[model samples]
Target: MNDKPLSGRKAQAARNDKLILEAAREVFVADPEAPIAEVAKLAGVGISALYRRYPSKEDLLRKLCGDGLARYTELVREALESEGDLWGAFREFLRKVVVADTPSITVRLAGTFTPTSDMFEAAVAADELNRALLARVKDAGVLREDVENGDLALVTESVSSISLGDAERTRELRLRALELYLEALRAPGAGPLPSSAPSEEEMGARWVPKQAK
Candidate 1:
């Protein structure tokens, strides 16, 4: 891998690439169906620049979701190997999830684009890690008995709705919301939940592009 600093046109291209990915995250993460032109406009780069980098809207979406999934799986793998109490590890995992802000990726843009095989594999691996963490917490008797694999996703997904148009403040608000949910999870002798957890199959269906179906 070359570490040499890029100069002139190459340097500017790198900068534009960064802007495009960041703007894409902000734009498509908010509205999966938003046009690619929106990403270019928000990125402050011309449509030609974005097309040169991503070629197509689906290409950009796959890149964004793939990045999100990779980060999430990495965190989950770390949590599995973490020390200290099980509850603490689970709490840390939830906190990291908020910081990663990945629930929105799976919740919002899932079915809008076709996923590659690599993306599907990562999703499966992340799911296995999540179930392991939940199982450990359940056995420790801290988490509510009714909580299920899919329930955890919903708990985190709820925080995705807290957008104050400011990153720092939005994170703070989301953390506060997580605390409330944590308290609810610890409810003593909680009654049975109203429904069963969603299976991976049901969730996977959303990853299939609408046109593919």
Candidate 2:
């Protein structure tokens, strides 16, 4: 046998898989209902290869959702570490999640399909991390005392849903909604609110509907 080692085809294949996943994320973000064939076309991979990697659309979606959530968790950790402004960091975290290419897939899949393995545990860990971050913000008094844990959960879900809308519109709407939420959370008798508060329409579009009293 030749002394030379096998060519780095394995590394190349790994890189190709990453590229395919990146393309798949774009397709999913743009068209959540798009077929797997469309994802394969966008990823420049054959249908057979796609199926070999992801057995079903739900499987592909689960991978994408997990990847997105992982990134989101990292971003939240980074924001908390880097930004001294507690509320500002929280707002930035929301912005990142909303603008993320994959937002609602995790929630959607969780509600519709049971995870087959321990993967759901990772999701639980993520949620715990999120709660820790929120608790830190609460300790800093950036979030209102009356803001229940459920409120934050709804905020995240709502923001993710809004962000999955038209990109430009989502950006504008998210900012406005953040402003309103922040305003509501501010200390009693705080000075005039920010001049850049979003208009009624923007708030309506981005604001997650409050639960019925």
Candidate 3:
């Protein structure tokens, strides 16, 4: 096998880019407003290399938002298309969206900005598909008839409502909370919920940490 200088450089550049991206995702999930230098440090790359790949923090966030949205939309699509029980599929969607890979970022960006054209389109598609899935569940008498799209949005946003403890414990706390919410959504023997819900301002206030702000 022969490795040309140009090809070698390109391969190294690709590897560095992946490392930077993965590091950025991890750092940002912990603190979205983390400095670019922090990401470079975590990636074990020079700041110059990080900047060469992503010119600025906003640029990196834009890329992450687009990529996250695309992946999330695909998850919903796969769940809907899978040849399995409708209720199980719906629960899986809830579980993944709430607690799966990079969920903190996804939740942070939920119903927020469309950083790019592709992201905008993906957001629209995700919303439409989400509604369709909920409709199917409602029609099948699995989920309650009152479970509107807003209910799902509320549930997602609720992830930000409370902080049980440390970052390491956050996922466990969120999953436990989600399980309670899921049980409440069941069609049969469901109890009444409070007439009022949390406001966007309130949820937004809690979503990001004070340091990140």
Which has the greatest lDDT? 1
Q: Pick the candidate with the highest TM-score.
A: 1
Quote the positional error of residue 203 for candidate 3 in Å.
10
* Candidates, ranked, lDDT: 1, 3, 2
Local distance difference test, each candidate: 0.86, 0.64, 0.73
Decide which is better by TM-score, 1 or 2: 1
Provide the RMSD of all predictions against the true structure, rounded to 1 decimal: 2.3, 8.7, 5.3
State the weakest 10-residue window (summed lDDT) of model 3.
202-211
- Candidate 1 stretches with Cα past 4 Å from truth are 1-11, 187-189
Count clashing residue pairs in model 1: 0
For model 2, the superposed segments whose C-alpha errors exceed 4 Å read 1-8, 29-33, 80-83, 107-113, 163-169, 187-213
lDDT of 3 by residue, 108-165 (tens): 5443332556655766788788778888888788898766666776786676455677
lDDT of 2 by residue, 1-213 (tens): 777754698666676678678877777766766787988888787888788778888788667767866787787677667557887787777767766633455444333323434555765666667667767887887775555444555565665566536768877887677567657665442554344433334422322222311
lDDT comparing candidate 2 with the true structure: 0.64
Off by over 4 Å in 3: 1-7, 101-103, 106-114, 160-170, 189-213
When 2 and 3 are scored with TM-score, the better candidate is: 3
